[model samples]
Target chain A: MKAGHRHPADDDQDATTQLAGIATLARQLATAPPSVPDIASRARAWRRRQARKLAPAVVAAAAAAAVAVSAGVIPGSGGDSPAAVTAAPAPAPPMQTVRFLSSMASVAAAQSAPRPDVFWYERVADETGPATESWESTTQTGLLRAADPQQTSAIAPTAAVTYFAYEPLTFAQMRALPLDPAVLAARMRATLRASGRATGEHRTGSDQEMFESVRYMLGWGQATPELRAALYRMLATLPGVRVLGQGTDPHGRRGSVIVVALPLGGVRAMLVDPADGRLLAAGASPDDASPDDASPDDAASQAPAPAATPGGPGPWTPPADWTYRGPIHYNVIFEASGYVNAVGRRPE
Target chain B: MRTAEGFEPWYAAEFPRLVASLRIATGDAGLAEEAAAEACARAYAKWGRVRRMESPSGWVYVVALNEVRSALRRRRLERNHAGRLRAGHAPPPADPDDALWRAVRALPERMRLAVALRYVADLPEAEIATAMGVARGTVAATLHSARRQLARELAVLTIKETP
Candidate 1:
């Protein structure tokens, strides 16, 4: 993201020659049609036909990735494993080998053993800072409620927990997803714009000022539910990656969320409250911890909980040309745009 | 504030040219087109924020050109590090029609954008700097660096052809 190195002064002559060589090669390959109407039509067709075919596979692959996350994507609810945080716990019922297909089945079952309080019903609770207002219960209706409906396990409480495999409705999850890239871009743009200019002197304000970033980012919650549903569907189609058994983080939070493996891993992880559905704050996974450790916030002692978590906060825009693999929610897309260019090799 | 009425004509006129230059610079037509569109989209979305800047087109060029450089860099990285597990194959060797474009791709990401703007897209160094959100001296230095890189690449190719 930052510039590396460049030489000036006497280096000018050499720079020009280099620029010319590269530009010359580029000029020769410019065979695109000179017409605007044609290009637009082609782009439109690609989005409709090619994009449509590509979208579902991406969802499929991502769904597979999601399954991977059951051990890796979201942290294991039972946070004592030594492996990657994103790895999901195997769904081996108490003494039974009941293979789990989703974290909902596993986590739901784990939580099924009833607690005496209401906090257990609410997986995340907001204490303070950033996304506080957004804290609400998943048991309530609408996308605002739970992180994943498909992955949710059915809990039968009789002063004790009972987690029976109740795989959430995938179709219902898909139906409530977002798909249009352009619309997503627009909403993000608007939210970002509002954040920059929303202030009076642009310097500072009350507790409201602290929430500026949240206002711009999470404002999408206010958009039409239809769009939210579309996003839900899109996210569901992303790879299924759940963290394996959870463990204590370097910062020492009694437990840690898992990390998506390399190749498909996203940058940070969200830490939701086990008490309320609200997100507390978000910081980098332990792997992302910086070298300096000088910044108190960057270090574990005072790091804010990540307000955004997978299937909870906004989705990460997939890198271009990379096909969306698992559920859109998994963020495990791959860059398979242009590997092979023409004919192939002959047999030896 | 600038309506399509005010900008469309200029855009339609320059759009094809921009695409051609970006395609070469990025070594991928898709990347070029997307970069150009994303830059313009941002421009169109934030016309008010940029109208008063030194040169509006320059600003757009900076964004689009940078996009080209970034796209090229990303493509190269994916090709090199991703391995055969899932990546597509490397692109075919370049034809002359796209030689300069490939060369553009070969440039370091930032330098490539600066060169594309100063040479291929054909804008002044100052405006290029503004569009790129860098100091004027930075733009000048970047242009110089790109030219040097271009010459070396050309020289290498020329030497190989000698009898």
Candidate 2:
């Protein structure tokens, strides 16, 4: 070991012996390490895969950067202003993402607040199992039913309303949240700090977490049209958020994808319907695998195979023009959500 | 950017060690190979930058560990989702037939990673800390705790097996 880099077992003979024994066992397990092929060939293959996956992102980023340069908003260019006055230059937001989100905000704003209903119903499914249907009432009671017949239906107290960092909120508290994007962003930061869940100074992870929280509120919380609009606008201001072009949900619905690049190599992607601005699906994908390149075994183990539409079609496949990105780890699709009169009722 | 010439020798030397360490860290051999290959490919892609680091091997370790973590998180989420659908469903426990390996595998996730890096990768606490993205002190504490737990578990196993 290098000087000043002591092993934990160095001080104790027994610990050292134990670690050595463990090391020996580990070595025995690895006696025949998997054979490696030609390094150059492997590297070449990897480059090809990555190029195919990253081409769209590279083109989109280049276009956005070009637009920023033309607009005199060069990224990472520190101007002549005093250091105190001049904040670090932020990455230019992807122009296409900005446009799509701005449109989503407008669509959200044009809609009126939903009428008060006794129950809120949602049908959701993830790469886990069959779809789950839940009906929650304002009275803090709810019923949950799984599509699988073997699973027993559950009737329990509803989960508390929460928003932006899982900070519990009452209807009054949610209504009092600021509407301006900057102010709302500040409020969210404050909420994250106060919740005591924020750890480390990793800014990118915190931003990604905040984005997910806002998405959760938009999908399930009782956000009014006005609040939803503000939330969408706030998302546009977050650094590292970008457009991953178009993609399809598990249900075969086509939507525009906006992704937040995770600090570690991957992305948290949300797909939104272009016409209505409703969120269709959300998922995370590692940097290596393309979204549609998930192995059959992995898909079968994790996600329920897409069910055939009653009389419409079979499982959806990506078209030739589909943009390939990263491998999806887990995808949650929001099948439907609406106010309802009672338990077990779905939106028409 | 360092030319591909520099990457070939380093890749040949470090790849097997990385896979071995990752195999211990992740109980799944297949995941270890996949993560190691992926991390090496990434390193090769960014060889110019990675070669300038104090320890290129340390960088590869971090990337491979992150890959393993992402996969584990995905599996956990899927399991949780499956658990919800099938109420009371639980994932199977790690294999208990091999007491030593079982003890190592049974350690908390962070502790397991620390142990694997320290023993299998032969990394010092400082490098392990960097790879795990924790403070050096935290790495020492984690390894210390893991050692004690492993010793106790192995002792118990030995006693149980005594005729």
Candidate 3:
């Protein structure tokens, strides 16, 4: 019967028996002192990281401000959101939300386009302290200055001039982007997907990513007023966007905030100047209420260890401490932004 | 939570097998672990869905192999001969000239993966087919070819040893 088997049963068994030594080798190698990371735990860590990445854009702040904002450790937290002294607890009547977003959009649309020049200059100030003044050129020459003495000095030379790794789009390129919000959304989705950032099994480029892309353009890339208007229009179509009433930015700039609820109990709020439709600040508040067994007090106790802030690709950092109820806001107060002839030279 | 509980045992059982198979296939233990850990992490991230797939282990093997290939490609790009020792080149064999491991590493990439999945991972032909994304018969043939070559190489080594 064994000889009659079509599968070469005895031969296969002989092969398997012959390969037993290989199995022994494998088992021995497996037993060798593990030089690699624990996959199970590493997998869990990656999931946590992806979960944070999938969270909305509110956590996206400028890179320079990140260290200062987690300011409890670094003395003299410049431009950090002042611990709001809760004052007159008045019933802040229902804020007029629609008129707010649309009017902001109108002002944003009407703003004049920046004139063509060699460099784009911007000075951004935070609420409590620290500010970064950056000058960039389409030719890829760049300079950055910050309040920190180390950061503040003679305009230094940098290798690349493109705004935010995705080379800053020329004003013309910004205009050439898909004008239709739906088409624009698709284009942005394709860009995000191509970057491989949108790769978790359940990923589909959501409006949240669009929001970040737009913010990135606004922060690093040149965005014509028309492009800014289109971004707002695109954002208006996305689900889960809501007005959070009027709030003051860390820069003390008053703006109406629109919050987007993120996946797995997180929220991102963008503070837009209702007067000019300028995005003043962005912040994120994670769902402090997750983790079934932990009490709020337990969370607060776990909060201050200053978990590694993500300084990777995106400008965002998830809520490091589970205890915080408020968002960590990145306020951009543009003192001067225009075309400059050189990287070191501020625009006249 | 139920799914989490379900995956834990599955992970524990496969972790060592994956490490050993990848170690043999890539000829670098550290690279093997990194690749396996990365694939396993992706699996965990999508556990809610990955656990439902027909062969999750197969998926992991595929992802790990890709990782190794990419690392090798990157190492080639860097033109760092020293870096090659870290990722792809077989380490100094314990016996200095270990014939078996040298012969296994000498196999073509696909054949090496086939051999590792077959003997080290101890996977059946059907599952090996799933892991390698080939037909079941192809896996069988590949294993046969690998065995023949390995046997020939070992014979030559033995003859040389006898002399």
Report, to 2 decimal places, the DockQ of model 3: 0.17
The TM-score-based order of candidates, best leading, equals: 2, 3, 1
* Candidate 2 residue A249 C-alpha distance from true site, Å: 7.2
i-RMSD per candidate, Å: 16.1, 9.9, 14.0
CA RMSD (A), model 3: 18.2
**Model 2 collision count:** 1
Q: Put down candidate 1 lDDT per residue, A1-348, tens digits, no spaces.
A: 111233433346654544555544545544433244443444454345433334433453454355435644344454544233334332211111112112222332233222222112122111111111111222322212122433432211111111001111222442333346335433433433342232111111111112222211112122223433332222222232233233332233432232222122323333222222112233343443332221111121121111133332122223322221221111111111111111121111
DockQ of each: 0.11, 0.18, 0.17
User: Which ranges of candidate 1 are over 4 A from the true structure?
Assistant: A1-348, B42-54, B65-104
C-alpha positional error of residue A136 in candidate 3 after TM-score superposition, expressed in Å: 1.8
DockQ of 1: 0.11
Sort order, lDDT high to low: 2, 3, 1
- B46-85, model 2: which lDDT tens digit per residue? 7888888899998889878766654543432232332432
The top-ranked prediction according to DockQ is 2
- Stronger candidate by TM-score (1 vs 2): 2
Candidate 2 chain B lDDT trough over 10 residues, lowest sum: B73-82
* Deviation (Å) of B158 in candidate 1: 2.3
The number of the candidate with the highest TM-score is 2
lDDT of 2 by residue, A1-348 (tens): 231244435534444576666666655554332233444455677677555434433443354344434434544455533331224344445666677778889988888787868766777777656766766566543333334335525321224454455444657778898999889987886665453322211121145555666766766677888988998898887655676767888888888787665432466677887676677887767552344333211221121112123221111122223333665543678889888876766778
User: In model 3, what is the error at residue A76, expressed in angstroms?
Assistant: 64
